[model samples]
Target: GMAEEEARMMRIDPEKLTQIILMGYTTKEARRGLRSAQGNIDQAVEFIIENRRLREECHREEEAREEEERIQRRYGLTENGQKINITYLQQLQSMGYPRRACVEALKQSNNRLEEASEMLLTNLDTLITASRVAKRDNEDDDDQETELMEDATHIPQLIALGAEFEEARALLEIYGNRLERAVEELLQKAQDSYETMHEHNDPSLFERARTAVEKRMAKKIRLAEQSAADQQRRT
Candidate 1:
């Protein structure tokens, strides 16, 4: 009688409550469902049925999307509007073309595997030469002289200040390793960049144009004077 009364409070028949419990629901869980349904057995059953149906639908949708992705990958159809054949990729790789380079060529050749391969082969020499040139450029970047200049206290200090070692060495060379002049040159460059970024025009466009011309003339005069002084010093 007590069990039946408890089931009545849940608004379900005792047999239905027993069946729900036997279907792996705890009594506490069944009680929660009754509360959610406002003690309506029919509503609670309907809610549980809808929930299960929605969950299954979501699961099926997710499985379908995953299967589509798997099929796409197997056929080498990229999601990025490019259709690359896996067999073509393997054939290119076998012929020593880099995978990334092959992909690029394939895209450029409109995904025609034979055309992509031919393009790569036809320009192989030019490509190799270009690649070598790029590599040499990188090596040149790395080969900045690390050796300390004869009069410099630190080579890395100049490098840290964004001066290539050779550039710093040349500055030091020209100034006979005077740290002050080298540092001044670097600071001047920074100042020039700051002035360029912050430079404001006069309210009058004529005034702005005049100021620019004057600055250019003054720069030329200064350069001529410096050149003369350098030549006299050399003599």
Candidate 2:
């Protein structure tokens, strides 16, 4: 509506009256300023306020961006710097230090990688020393218990009564050899039993009776050996 009125005024005999209203000045003020300035409403308005404001805003934004760039440069917190720091942290983690510990070590070392690694190694050494001390203390406790038990029991009496050292050593050696042989025989027997069990789901009654007879014969042989040994020891 204002623009239409201005256009109507411009279409009238004088175009100056249209410029005064659009330039936000009264007709008398427009006339006074018209001698020094042209009656150009657009240029006047731009010069008076709009252009300055736009230029100031643009300058402020540019300064703000420059200040941000300056801060990032000063602190070395740019993209490349972040990448380098991340790589450093990863290297610390790969070297067996926990991430949080690595970060703290880095800070304590003034962000020096070598110093941080040395600190971490020192911490590990401390932990290892503590663990060894604990293990030694545990071993000492066990030794004390064993000594106490030995002092409380009658070990000498047990050794004297039917406990021949040479015979016991010889028997243990023989038993060890026998155990190896027995294991091999048991493995073979187990394999054979598995095969036999799988091969024949049902067998004749005579076959079952024959297996029972063989088991009884082996048991009688063991009993005879044991009886002969007992009789020899008594004599």
Candidate 3:
């Protein structure tokens, strides 16, 4: 019910998603950000709750997207738009080339089995190198994906401390391995975001939160300076 309703609300403009990705947001973040920016918020509290749910759903949606991409890369669909011929791929693979290289050759040859087989035989080295580069990129992404799992360990703690799951994970990722820092930042965001979302309806409270954030940052700077000075003296 909610899935259909949300789909109706935001179909996710592919052009917007591409532009957002080019602007340096990850594909997942771009999708989530689009959902957030396009949501029609009736109330601040409701928006906060809804945003959390949307973010959680964004994770699942992104997973599905990743699966689709893998399928396209390996198997290729039957229709147009970069679809590889599975038969061509299989035949080429039977010739002892990698599935990755075979898929690339098939796509490069427009799914003509003879041409694809010829390319695989003639340009095997280049095809293998290109696939290696792509595999390397995917490996790098796998490392970053592992980092997301590492960040997840702190979610229960944050939730127990009364912060939302998705918000806590986002803050922890932004802060990177600093549980205390992420918690403080999450609290600040919760306060500031509600005020900002509500059209500054409570400017006084927002101002106080800003003041506290400034003080915290100053304290961190002072601590860093002291540590650096101590190191300099030791040196």
lDDT (10s digit) by residue, model 1, range 142-163: 3232333243333335666877
Number of clashing residue pairs, candidate 3: 0
Two-way TM-score contest, 2 vs 3, winner = 3
**lDDT of all the models against the reference?**
0.62, 0.49, 0.66
**Could you tell me every candidate's TM-score relative to the true structure?**
0.26, 0.22, 0.27
List where candidate 1 sits over 4 angstroms from the true fold: 1-19, 22-32, 78-235
Candidate 3's error at 189, in angstroms?
72
User: What is the TM-score ranking, best to worst?
Assistant: 3, 1, 2
> How well is each residue in 63-82 modelled by candidate 2, as lDDT tens digits?
97775454333323322233
Q: Could you give candidate 3's per-residue lDDT for residues 35-114 as a string of tens digits?
A: 77673222322444566689889999999778656656544443346576555665654444556676667766777788
| Candidate 3 global CA lDDT score | 0.66
By TM-score, how accurate is candidate 2? Answer: 0.22
Q: What lDDT is reached at residue 174 by model 3?
A: 81
Best by TM-score: 3
